[model samples]
Target chain A: MNTVSTSPYLAGLLQGQPPASPLTWLNELRANAVDRVGALTVPTTRDEDWRFTDISPLTKLSFQPAQGAAQLAPAAIEQWAIPEAAARLVFVDGIYAPGHSFNRAGLTVENLASGVSRHGAAVQAHLGRYADFERNVFTAVNTAFLHDGALILVPRDTALAAPVHLLFIATRKHAASYPRCLIVAESGSAVTVVEDYVALQSEAYFTSAVTELALTGNAEVHHVRVQREGAEAFHFANCAVSLAQASRYHSVSIALGGRISRHNLAALLAAEGAECRLDGLALIGGQQLADSHTLIDHASPRGSSRQLHKCIVDGAARAVFNGNIMVRPGAQRTDSSQSSRNLLLSARARVDTKPQLEIFADDVKCAHGATVGQLDVDEVFYLKSRGLSDTAARNLLTYAFGAEVIERIPVASLRNRLEQTVMERTHAAAPGAEGKP
Target chain B: MIYQDSKTLLSVRDLHASVSGTRILKGMNLTVKSGEVHAIMGPNGSGKSTFAKVLAGHPSYEVSGGEIEFEGRNLLELAAEARARAGVFLGFQYPIEIPGVANSQFLRLAYNTVQAGRGEDELDPLEFDDFVREKMKLLEMNPDFLDRSVNEGFSGGEKKRNEILQMALLEPRLAILDETDSGLDIDALRIVAGGVNQLANKDNAIVLVTHYQRLLNYIVPDYVHVMDAGRIVKTGGKELALELEERGYDWVGAEAKANARVNA
Candidate 1:
């Protein structure tokens, strides 16, 4: 535990390490990121976003950077692989697994380590460009550590026919992994990226991830970050997406595992005529906790944004959803709406959801609502009267509660996988169980 | 006491029930036999719906004093699902719409439950699918209807048709059609009644509870019982429904109260 003095040990690991790249341009950004990380601190209950989700587990966990020349066996890779992905990028213990990545042309996919070691120029231009590190301590810490992650660049006017799947697996217990991702969809380009943060081992673990995306002018990007870590693990992530003129951005955040988890997601509709849609679902059980904090900024005129988040909590589990949508002045016709619905499956289960909307533009249409309730009794009785047992009744109602959001995922096989995982957790009243399809 | 015979399918003796401490069904008595259909008709606020709801074991309704025996087994001792498993089906006047449970899924569950209760192995998904498809075709229902949520967006006639479809699947020993024809067009009435007529077998009984006599023209009942002020006051053959439709409920109510006073 003493080895884990700070949130992440990457900064200390690279303190005296020699630069493998010919250029030293990124050194300045690295120093700046470290300074930013040094300045910010983990939040407490006093902070608005950290009000419901407890951060003690994160502060107490022991973390160490992955050592050099550690090989993840092929059998382990095959057992936990995402076969449905068009392209797969594997990161084990926060280090890029060399033989595990499958890259193709018209789409540039590579490990952040290779780009930083060999191609410093391209790495310096985009790293830590889209996130606001100062506002979130976890995001700043990830940037400072930033050892390795997946970097995907979609060339201008090029649209990938399939989804690029990024997988980060936690293979060591009582250890921390920092997986950073940056996706750039160039002008007139279209691409979809699915980032999965999964725990390969059942032992206790902590994973802090940062994913940044930028959609260039007239570009369309769909990004989904699904975290289904093992129980006895602490998961934290920060996702930021920015849209340019006439570009479209859609994101779905699903938090279904981890003993303690929190997600910080922010989207900026900065270009005129751009559209942004954000949806999320969180299924929590056991002593597990999942909290999501989202902010949407409608900065330009005629841009629209919509957000919907649903949460289901059972057992002694707790869930939190805090969403804010801001329509700035002169951002007229910025249609934005946000809503959060929660279902408490047990008397001990709890949910705290808040939807905040700030509309400086009088002409903008912005509305928000939040609801926390148990399963509808009449609905339960109706199903039970039809011969379904009580468990079946509650399970059906809870599945429906989250199905509306899961259905919007647009990935059939992926949605089915998440639905199965959620159903299994629904029965055990705990995270990290297997579900029957 | 009514239907003092072992051949009776459903027997009620001075049945009394209440909701929220307020008694609704006071001394209601009725009986039915296999192969015969009975229609209980009454005016509004006459506790006509209470008898149907009580038999279905609605939690809100308390059975204060009653002996409801279905196939010689005590009905009040069972829960709603138990009563359903015991082969007593209630076609709700206004069926509740369950948003997430799919129509075919709910029907399969109901069918498997009844089958299991009768000591039969539950049909697997493929077998259940085949079974449901055949039943849907028999009722002239579209195959796509099974994919939708249970009556989530069903029309009035569609809801009634769905009820009859369930009846055909479960093959209950006693079917309680609670105002099944209240919200239907003449065409919908014929289709729904046709489905119900096809499902009623000689081994099962049908209790059609309605206010109007029009539905009787399609699925004619063996007997019509006139209920007023929480008790059945008149019992006659099928023609009784037509006579009451013409004479109105006012005369029946006046005659029932007068007869009670004379007996007192």
Candidate 2:
């Protein structure tokens, strides 16, 4: 119905798009998403929110939807799985893989493709409600191509003993993927979910992921996402959360890969005395560009939030952080704070950080700050003076910088794994590292 | 160089060094033989600290012309860490605080590193804990300090005591304590001096870089040398320290200027 021509990538995507499921309501959502995306123009640098990131290359590339799940060997797949996790949902190139996943009792994890046939009513009640697809282009794209994802449903008054992990692996070459998930936690329930994005092959690809969560009264949730994709990949992910009265939400996002990766995370405190904690760590090097934008909205009275985002840039890599806290009117006694700390390891490396607090409420307490600096020279020299090698000194300090955020995780085994991963990615110095060490 | 024992531990001959194109040490000469404790005293801006840093292979000091031999090896050829492993310790006047790194871990790494250099067996964490606790008793340090970050939020006196604790652990053969007594109270000064006195023996040498004569009162020096204008102008026994404290450095500077003019 439109006169304007679509980008080549969009044209290719539409041609290979899979047919919607037989459920009429699900089909209606997809049909509405297609028209919504067609009418709204793509975001550009001129937009205030998208000023720092350039998506022209993403629009120019001619990519089609992945044909099928990648058939990676079982041993390679097991090597990446967390053995201690209570349950797991494994997806390969936007399709659920049964052989690679393990589901335990006490929680309902339904695959979206098959979920529509069984729990279609519960799924339809929560899927498209939390994620604002109308204003977000990537969310609109994901909704239009919502073929398969995990549907997590936690019952009332139930507490998951251990974390449920979602392992989303990419193996499609030069293809675009849309991965979606919706989690609904009932009253007085508690759960923790971890999503890990990794690629089996080192080929160019596009991955746009969206996750929605709705926590009812007195529910608690912990969400952790780790992105370790390949060097030639482009990754964009958004997590939208809604917290009810007296509920708690805590989330941490760690970005260590992808040539160009962008993460947008936002939480809405909709009821009285709801609390949330948002923290993240980003480690990018070697011509990589990683950007993270976060928002914490306090809509009700006496809501509290804390946010901390840290970045370490090296080897001509660039990092950007934009954190906004909005304390709306009538949200009295709202306590919100945000801090962004960045360490640049090379002169060629760059970082731009902005922490904003927009308080319309009269009796709210809020604070925010951003700091960009290199490692301390005198500290490095002091380490070297104690018989540590130059590289060892730098590695120690760099690890300590990122460990501040990793230490906030409560799981010991998961923390140990992240520590090792951070060590491997942070061992090398950026060019000279330039200090006396 | 004159000494009762024949073996020399450190020999600096006509050392000239600069930092950032500004000359700091000009043709400095000193010699310390084994079984000796030497104290280098000077007024401010006499390059006493610079000489200590240069001897420890600090990267800031560019050696325009110098030759330093420690334990019969050319100290200039070794890197800073190599010099540390080679048993040359420089106790900093101002210790830097490294946040987020535990003090116990830093001490373990440092101890194991130097031990490995000497082909000695390295201690694991459990073994090193017992060893470090025994060493801490020598300085009267609490065991709870092991849990805190390295020098973070520590008082000035506590930092000085930590420097002494490192000296006890490393057991360096030639230690140049640069102004180790600058920021210490009387009680802290006593403990630090007592630890240094116990560590000194006939097999090694100690060089104390200080401004006041109070430190020499506790740890008596075999030789006290006066440095003026980046060069040693007077050398005598421990009695010189008392004389310098009593009559002040102006007399020495005047005498040195007169001698220099006569020689020229």
Candidate 3:
């Protein structure tokens, strides 16, 4: 390795890391991640992957790793309770809060620190394996700091009737938290997992999260990730998934908060007849920035993937979507399509959407499109002609645009909560520019 | 249905309008009394649609110089939604499709908004469902339409029928139908025309802007006006539709040009 010193930013973030794990393999994994973090530096706008997103604001601040979990009352988190969730794993400031969590599904759903000791072989086989921390500094940092997180392993031929919710809440200012999750679905098993990131404080904080999912043959997994951090926080996340033969993976991620947030998702279709569907939405306003980058790799024959991402931006906020689909050389009959649509609710609001498709297989079918525009005037007029005011019409249309993705969520209480949040945000963002004659 | 003391519902005086700096309605004038059905017929690009849009206060069209009075109020000063609340409706030739909004929700909101503007109590969803279902039967519409998105994936004729359904719900005093029968089959046309005929009464007036005399045959107009070059050039009774149907619009344009030359 090159003898380059760690940058002051990385050195500052490396402070207050948890002590080494008792498990040797886990300790070795953490040691390798620490070395990778030392080798890599924080990316800038000049980096091709971060050309549109400028994260210098994130580097200017110093953050210490959270030491202990904050004392939160049960009532503080009662509003986020999902009546349909079979289990909930609550993490406060990246530390597991066992007092506020429950699991009734009789599955292996527990904190990673304790889980690694019990499921050591299984955890070592998958943990830090799919998500490549060598090249990515944030993932490396998350891997280096990963000690306690949400761990779920579904047994073979088992199907859970209810979902598992992983709730990560930020409660401190100028503190950095690494939230990690690993889910493995065995052959012929199915599960629904929800990864939720929220905040109890409005002050500036940093959240770096990494999630890995592995689906074996004939396994199915539905993943829903929602990031609603504080207005002054910084959030970055990376999710890597691998699909085996005839396995299916479906994911819907919504970004509605954070001063500066970025989420990177990569799905690898490893074996034949694997399928993946990805849907995302970022509803932001008021100088906030949300960036989403997704990659769907069809590496085997008969693999299919479909993705749709939408953004509704208001005020001076900005949203970015970069989606890439790759059909490998031997991946015949690979079918994939992606659409990126954005709505700018104000003149100052901005959107950057890019859809890329690469197909080496001649018989593969791939289509992609990107659109950034204001609301359709004809649609607004149609609603207005029916006696709705201009403001109401624009708000309704904006809500409808985001609702297309929200409707895909399977959980009823979560879906209703998100619908209410979308409606409130759209209405609150609809006054100044939308009400103009 | 014309009464002895039928009041004037709409009066357009020298309505000059343009869209994107191109003059569309140049000094167009018309007056409609309550209970009268007027047909504004013209060839393509003859300002028939523009006239209907202008009356509805479409934002794209600029009224550089004009005045429109609806029920003795200055309709030009009101916004599109305000005009709708003020009992003015425009049936678009190509109704817009809103993909995510349910049809029942849209219709109920429209109905409640108009009802609230009239100082009447609004009905809840259950009450409105009963009220709207009864109205849908008049147009022979399927109840399943309530569950689908508004006008999304609807056939051309189905969109027109939806427009009439809204008209029936809102009960506007002055209704302008701009090519409402453009894309309908014979059976759809008969059903749609029957719905419009049923909604028309002595308290309201209907204005049909069409290019063909086919729609006029069903919902017969009391007066037929031929428009050309952005202004009406010929005005006659219902028989004029039949005459124009047989002897095409070329003679009318020629006659208008000759008349303009003689007057000049």
lDDT of each: 0.79, 0.85, 0.91
Q: Chain B, model 1, TM-score against the native?
A: 0.96
TM-score of chain B of 3: 0.99
- What is candidate 1's lDDT per residue for B1-264, written digit by digit as tens? 123342778999999888889878889898888888889998987888888878877777889997999999999999887888888888888877866557887788778877877787788788989988898776688888898988889999888889888889888888899899988999989998888888877788899999999999999898899888788988888898999889988988898899889999
Q: After superposition, which runs of candidate 3 have C-alpha atoms over 4 Å from their true positions?
A: A1-5, A432-437
Instruction: Return the top candidate by TM-score.
Output: 3
Interface RMSD score of each model: 3.3, 4.7, 4.4
On TM-score, the stronger of 2 and 3 is: 3
**What is the TM-score of chain A, computed separately for every candidate?**
0.90, 0.94, 0.97
Model 1: residues with Cα > 4 Å off, grouped in runs: A1-25, A104-106, A115-127, A245-247, A301-306, A334-337, A363-368, A430-437, B1-6, B43-50, B94-101, B182-186, B211-214, B225-264
Per-residue CA lDDT of model 3 for A1-437, tens digit only, reads 12232787897788777887788888788778888988898999999999989999998899888887799999999988898999999999898999999999889999998998999999999999999998999999998888889999999999997999999999999989998899999999999999999999999999999999999999999999999999999999999999999999999999998999999999999999999999999999999999999999999999999999999999999999999999999999998989999999889999999899888899988988988999888888877887888888898888889888988898989998998898788888866433211
TM-score of chain A of 3: 0.97
Each candidate: fraction of true contacts kept?
0.44, 0.44, 0.56
Worst 10 residues of 1 chain B by lDDT: B1-10
Instruction: Give candidate 2's total backbone clashes.
Output: 0
Q: How accurately is candidate 3 docked according to DockQ? A: 0.45
Q: Is candidate 1 or candidate 3 better by TM-score?
A: 3
Q: In model 1, what is the error at residue B22, expressed in angstroms?
A: 3.9
lDDT of 1 at B258: 94
